[model samples]
Target: MVVEYEDSLEESSYSAAAHEPQDTARLAINASRQDDLADIIFLANNRRVTDMVASMPHPFTLEDAKALVKRSEAGHMGNTLFAIRMKNTGRFIGAIGYAPSMEDGGACHLGYWIGEPFWGQGYATEAAHAMVDFAFSDGGISTLTASCHVNNPASRRVLEKCGFQFREQSKMRMSGNSGLVNVDRFSLTRSTWKALKAWGQAA
Candidate 1:
């Protein structure tokens, strides 16, 4: 399924400067660039990374990375993809985006991945937060869903941190495993996001 953005939304709307205090910001999300091909190939080719994602193919190659950048340029499955870049150096460290889901009511699915070298540093959670905000505020989305392999506790933590609540357990085809795997699904609604934002401001 492909989630379609409103025609009123421009490509520039996908660019987000996440985390406050520009100089102190750790990262920013922006449209993917051709220059990011080498970095995407280098980071995405790792088994440790692709193994965690469902659609990413193992033995990831330069052509695959080039296709990814092209998709980002042209819109991947009707969804805009973003590069997760370090604020200080402007280096691409990962990718993140939302896609259409089979779920009723126009719910979209959120997905992201970071380089193996950048893991354990809270990049996933930061990116998730930024993406969630962007989806609700700028993307005109009402519902967002996500899932992670049951064994990936780190990913589950990232979803929970972004205010996604557990929904159900399901099976999905993982390209790395070449079979269906158990996954834990989660979802968040616009109302819940608004409440969370209010609570955070009050706190």
Candidate 2:
């Protein structure tokens, strides 16, 4: 899923380090950089990648990548943007973060996308866990909302694994596809996230 938001907040940067017990042990959620533009364009230009995202334009150009980086630097309505990277190699594999859900009162909207080459790996889930943890613990978000194209089961699984509950299905215009598409919405509250964390720790 992709998210684009407006309004402004002072820029800030932080990192959320995650240690996974499986193959994704090296994942790190860090701020996007100017250096990431080339990599972003390369990975995001694929039709397979854009079709599943809502706002990302296909043929993802340098200008598009630059605009994204600028937004990350500027911060969007209390939004936090992170680059999903390999801690060991410092390679940008994907992007994930959240923004205030203006329509949902105090809720924040979570969104993410992984490169085509990295599909089927657990990187998305691992990064999502880190983002969710950061959102609740450090980002001061009381609730998180996310949505994905109805056909994208991979994304649905990521949200499910992260404790988001199905909320609804709605239609939205996808810029990448240049048409309207059906999307499934999901939400996770702070209390639920805390319980899940406590359960995991207890286990």
TM-score of each: 0.84, 0.84
Please give, for residues 1-203, the per-residue lDDT of candidate 2 as tens digits: 11111211111222223221112466866767899988999999999899998879987999999988876676543476777888798888888878876545657888899998888978888888877766665334578999999999999999999999999998877889899999998999878877876666556
Off by over 4 Å in 2: 1-24, 102-106
Clashing pairs in 1: 3-100
For residue 77, give model 1's deviation from the true position in Å.
Answer: 12
The true-versus-predicted C-alpha distance at residue 19 of model 2, in Å, is: 18
Per-residue lDDT of model 1, residues 1-203, tens digit only: 01123331343434433321111148877777889988999999998888889889989988888888876776533256788899889999998888887643457889899999999998888888877767765435678899998989999999998899999998888887688889999999978876776666556
Worst 10 residues of 2 by lDDT: 1-10
Error of 2 at 193 (Å): 0.1
